[model samples]
Target: MSKTRNPNLDVIRCLAVLLVIVIHFFLNTKFYDVTINSWQLEIMVGMRTICMICVPLFMCLTGYLMHEKELSWEFYHKLWPTLSVYLQSSALIYLARIGIFRERLSLADGVLGIFSYSTAPYAWYVEMYIGLYLLIPFLNMIWQGCQTRGQHQLLVATFVILCILPTFLNIFGKMIPDYWVTLYPLAYYFSGAYIHTYETEVTQIPLRLVTLMIVLLSVMHNLNASAGRIFQWLPMNDFGSSEIYALTIVIFVGILKARLPKTIGDIAKYIAPYTFAMYLVSYIGDQLIYPIFMNWFKTESAMLAWMAVPILLIFIGSLLLAIAQKLFWQLLRVCLDKFWQKYQVL
Candidate 1:
């Protein structure tokens, strides 16, 4: 049986989607074009570091929520909803590209773009998710097969060494072979599983300490960015560093342990289901919103001053679009069912 929805997990989902929008802000604005000499720019880099966990949060949430999954036809069938949403969202985005953006494309190319995820660029997450979804049952098998907490710890530790550690070590000078670091999702997945398996032990750490850890990490990220600017050899930021893994874990735990008000929890639960659709459809909002902001604000720094409004607009617009697509899909399903019933009677 499926587990009951956890409000805290839902809140994490909402936060993850919002951070998705936050990370994309760098791409939509002139964040990279300007020099990072100023403190404001350095702080922006820190925010980017924190937001980098957006994808990892989703992956870890998958492990936390679906740790009991096993290989079965019914289990595999769960993918249909995700696939359906993606295909429909892709079609809508394709139409927007042609109609709104006035991008020229032949019929075959349009269809190809939809299937290939080229039409909605952000749907690359969909491509990654499909592979991860297929592997979840097997991953759970490994999680379940562990006979003891120590064994579970060993398994998670091994994944960290192989997948997470290399990303951090290689940043300096390829200290370790990183052939398996691309498999970092498994490391995060197993970490989430470990947390869920030992919630009592994991949550025992004080929330204040958790917040402190995140703050210190954020500062480290800022310092790292500054050093990169000074040295020219170090990177300005590493996308999936060990720092992100540490932050993702502590944040997930802190939120899980907090006593959020019911109203806030309700809002989170409502928004959770739409996050996947929101993430996929946000590219539409970005395309529509960013140009207007660019026209209004002469400088990138000036635009940063009014960042919250555009982010809010994009979030709201994407949420509405996702809801509309979901309603349209449901209506079509109902119509097709009725037509089939009528044909069967005849």
Candidate 2:
């Protein structure tokens, strides 16, 4: 099948990357002295809950685009570059941390550390993404076999029960199978396929309703965090604590319906390809750059700096890196093609 690029999807990816950066800022920032009712605390909780939509939206897009594609050498070929970035970024982060902190790095530590993003926790998405890629073919089979919308909906409903419902119940102290967590991405994969196949119109009303759900869920999360003792009857917070799935679908559909100027779509197409690169760069920023800012700025001053400076710096840096990566990949492709031609001539 030929590849077609959707400007709207690109816009979604670009937005997801930005959301990811802000979420990382919230996660790494220190709000220790801030009270539960403090503005900083509220902002942090809101950002995290809202930004949880990022990964799921990414997965949905992936499924929508690639679920039907055959898993061949081309599949791994496309994936290898992303894996390379993860490995190289992890190594660089490990080396930088050990060097700066004057920690000893043994051979086992060095080699193993390069593959594991121990110091750079945000790269956990890479591992999850690889798992999702492996399951795509199987997921495609399921998608293909479903002859009717009802059949697919039944499967999705079952997934919601087995994978999603348990997490909600767990918040209430009900224990479910631990294995259900592995199936969460599958639910999202199916969701993306459903959206694409059915071409459902997620109009303004549904978007507003989903937005309200996200707000309510975020507030519930903050209340639980601040007053867990009082809300002891609430389920244990797990994968289901937020409206991530709902918000992701809403955001994805909203983007699809949005009518933008040709100039904006053109810009989105240009920027969309670099979002993964931006994500990698931002992961490095979270590990290396943010800490320096955290220490430099003190107290509420730090929160303000976090809200302003770090985000801009990370964004600017990621944009440059993404552009550079595009150039680098282009050069590499040219070199490889030339080499293949020379060998064929020989």
Candidate 3:
């Protein structure tokens, strides 16, 4: 039998998807171009910093949930659903570009766009995830080999040093060689495995403390952005820095520790499965909604004031598209199965 779903993990998945939408807000708005002169802009910067944890949260959740997966044909076959959704979403986005945006392209270019993720640029995560999914079984083998908690801790620490520290240290005169920093996904994966291994101990961490750490990290990220603006040598933002790593851990733990109501938990569980689809189709919603809002509001700051509505509209629109896509695929599979069974009988 399949393992029961953990509502807490579901909630984390939901939160991760929402944060993904929130981060895209910056891209859709003039937040990047506007000068950070007012408190409104500063708040937006702080929110952007917090939302940067979106991708890490998803990566860590993968490690936490899939830590025990073994190498097998059955395990590898699970990737088909994700790949199917990605292809369908890409096709939908391409169609939208052609029909809604009136963008013209040859049939070959459209096919190539889906494969290359040019149709839905946000499907880049899907591309990254395909490689990571292939490696998970081997990754779990390494995890299962660890004889003790200390070994697991050492493994996580080593990853941090290799994947996270370089991006952080390189900020100041390239103090650390960052050639291995792209391996940060492995760092998050192992970290999630460690958390899963020690859930009892991790849950004991105070929720208040986790909140405090998140707040501090946001402040530091905001300051970092400000400093980068003041000094040309520094980066304007730290989207995938050690700060995001730390914040993702704290937020993940905090959500796990909190006592969510039954109704809220159930809602999260229902929404969680749809989140991957939502992320893929969100580009459609963004393209549809942002332009209208941008035209309505004169400044990025003005749009920020009424941001909640546009965000909600985009979320709802994307969720509807994802649900429709899911239904379409389900029906297709049913039809294919019926035809195969009839042919076999004949």
Estimate, for each residue in 1-346, the C-alpha lDDT of model 1 and write its tens digit: 9968679999999999999998888778877666666666666776777787788899888888888888999989999999988888888888888889998977788789877889778987888888988999999899999989999999998988887778667767878767877788888889889999999999998777766777676667566656445412122234345777878888888889888999999999998999999998999999998889888875646766888888899889989999999999899999999999999999
lDDT of 2 by residue, 1-346 (tens): 9767678888888888888887667667765334555455555556556776777778878877876777677876788878776655555556555776566776578676546755445677787888888778777887888899899889877776676666555665666664675577777788788778777543434576667776687567656666412222122232332256666777788888788778888987888867876887676566667778777876654575457678878877887766765677679889999999999999
Candidate 3 per-residue lDDT, tens place, 1-346, comes to: 9988679999999889888999888888877766677767777777877788899999999999899999999998999989888888888888888888888977788889877878787988888899999999999999999999999999999988878877667766778667777788899999999999999999897767767776676566566557435311122234456778888898888888788899989999888888998998898889888899888987656877898887888788888899998899889999999999999999
Q: What does candidate 1 score on TM? A: 0.93
Stretch of 10 with least lDDT, candidate 2: 228-237
Model 1 global lDDT (CA atoms, 0 to 1): 0.82
Q: Which ten residues in a row have the lowest lDDT in candidate 1?
A: 230-239
Prediction 2 TM-score vs. true: 0.81
Clashing pairs in 3: none
- lDDT pick, better of 1 and 2: 1
Rank by lDDT, descending?
3, 1, 2
Error of 2 at 2 (Å): 5.3
The alpha-carbon lDDT assigned to residue 85 of candidate 1 equals: 86
lDDT of every predicted structure (CA atoms): 0.82, 0.69, 0.83
